[model samples]
Target: MLQQSARDFLNRQAPVKHLRSLRDAGGSKGFSREVWAEMSALGWPAMAIPEEYDGLGFGFTGMGIVLQETGRTLTPCPLLSSAMMAAAAIVHAGDDAQKSTLLPGIASGEALVTLAFDEHTHHRPGQVAATAKRTAGGFCISGHKRFVLDGAMSDQLIVSARTDDRVPDGRGISLFIVPATASGITITPCQVLDTHVLADITLDDVRLPAAALLGAENEGLAILEYALDAGRIGQSAELLGVALEAFERSIAYLKERKQFGVPIGSFQALQHRAAVLFGELELCKSLVLNALHRLDSDANEIAATASMTKAKVVETASKATAEAIQWHGGIGMTDDFDIGFFYKRARILETMLGDRYFHLDRFARQHGY
Candidate 1:
């Protein structure tokens, strides 16, 4: 009931026009400090932090609600990258001192944080090539990270780097919290299909203090996996919302659109299609909710649940958005129509954190075939 109330409230706050206005005003950057401030005032960015850290402590469930609502309207914001993924990395791995220094700023919305993990075109966290060599006083990180969400606008970045070459895959990786404006760091902005901005970052011998290490030396892979599980759940919720919105729009279009002197919804074929999409949307929601509950619980199947949820959401949302476009006819293909935006976002989210095929493979491996 609490989740429902929060979802309804956010829906009211982020209607279609508000989202469209934000998209029009904010282009490549695609974020509004003023809007973020208002959200901060509402305590959104801090929703998952523990209450002891001056946050609302609503956990992933609360974050999921906010993301779902944002996805419904395609609201231009950094809530996913800053609040969900980056905050997860900190909460999971940051030491007490590091948490004390970072969590407060993140919870209060004074600092926007994002993860810089992917070094190549792929989404494999275990394939890290960025190296961070230890120095007398600190570490010098040198390498490139691609597809860093909101990297250009984020105030702090939690970067993953290889600290030991011997352990190759993931055992050698470490995470560091570095200021986005740190010396030797350069960010180049790139645009995604939904007009969201991602960054390709270059770290040319970027130096940081010894205190910058997020977790124990060479122990970041576990933290990254933990963060990815939570991130996948949060993303699935957003995709669920996107599909829900598209399905609703398709239903309304069916009712209003006319063919053969009757509302198109009266047609048996369209009705069946809507029904099938509705079922898929509800199933997606169930998977997301179940995954969220697993993460928040003592369940040992969190990884598998998360993979299942992510895979189902990727498939369901993409199909729902495609059906929405088909049901809406030619107008859906135009930029003026809102359905196209949802479709585009679905396409992008389908790949982030691994696609349907990737998650399916992970899920299978988690279950031992």
Candidate 2:
């Protein structure tokens, strides 16, 4: 029922044409507030949140279902940034008081939050250079972050900064909840190829109260990694949806398009390509499901599972979208066709969180390879 409802709602309210409209309007918001509000009413943002925090406590599997639907239609929203990623961070590390204060708003969709961990051109969660020096009253953070998802629009940011003067690795890291409007913080919007908005943020001695610190100081690397794994799994679910939709569209097109007075799908070469993609997508479905299940169960091997799922899903989605465009021929390359949108979205998602290479390396390290 959850999957069906999500699919129905997304198809009706936010089809591929919705993305086209948003891109054509050049909206800096990148997503619709009204549509997001509707989703909020339906408890999408609350899927994985616990019931104690005014949420449904549906868990990651339920959340993945909604994400998959959103990906199928290319819907733009903060479900990943605020609801899944930041929420996971808070749940994993935040004190009870912090959870009580933050989770309710996130559950209600009244507040938007995003994680800011990447400081370089690539997605390196542990190589943070941001510094949060202790002050008389609180802490003063100074650093620059790139590719912050929903950074400009979020109400609060879970900023990761180094607390000790150690090397720029996983240790000495801490997470802080910084207000988006905090003084000395600058956010500049950057538009990517997929018509999505990411922010380049600069913090020049941004001051925060002692209460703003999330989790124990200098012990945030674990929290950060936990949140990132959740985000990667959620992204894998979305990528799966993107690939499935693209594959379905391509198959439908192949049947309709004719070559030599017969359906192009009847050609053996095209059939072979479609068959290969179908099998790959099926395998991805199982991987995504397994990852989501592990997260919900708090399995011991979550790190490895998350990395493996992300790596496989990223690769599969890339192939599915590329083949989608190829099968559609010239029309797929044109901006006027919706198929091109899936290809662009796949490219962006491929690099987000951890790319194929990043996940492959992480998965190997996790397994002591």
lDDT of 2 at 35: 88
| Superposition TM-score, candidate 2 onto the true structure | 0.98
Against the hidden true structure, what lDDT does model 1 obtain?
0.85
Q: Using TM-score as the measure, which candidate wins?
A: 2
- The model with the greatest lDDT is 2
Q: lDDT of each prediction vs. the true structure?
A: 0.85, 0.92
Q: Please give the distance, in angstroms, between residue 94's alpha carbon in candidate 2 and its true position after superposition.
A: 0.7
Query: Between which residue pairs do clashes occur in model 1?
Result: none
- Name every residue pair that clashes in candidate 2: none
**After superposition, which runs of candidate 1 have C-alpha atoms over 4 Å from their true positions?**
1-13
Model 2 lDDT tens row, 80-181: 999999999998888889899999999999899999989988888888888999999999999999999988889999999999866546679899999999
Worst 10 residues of 2 by lDDT: 164-173
Question: Please, what is the TM-score per model?
Answer: 0.95, 0.98
How many clashes would you count in candidate 2? 0
lDDT of 2: 0.92
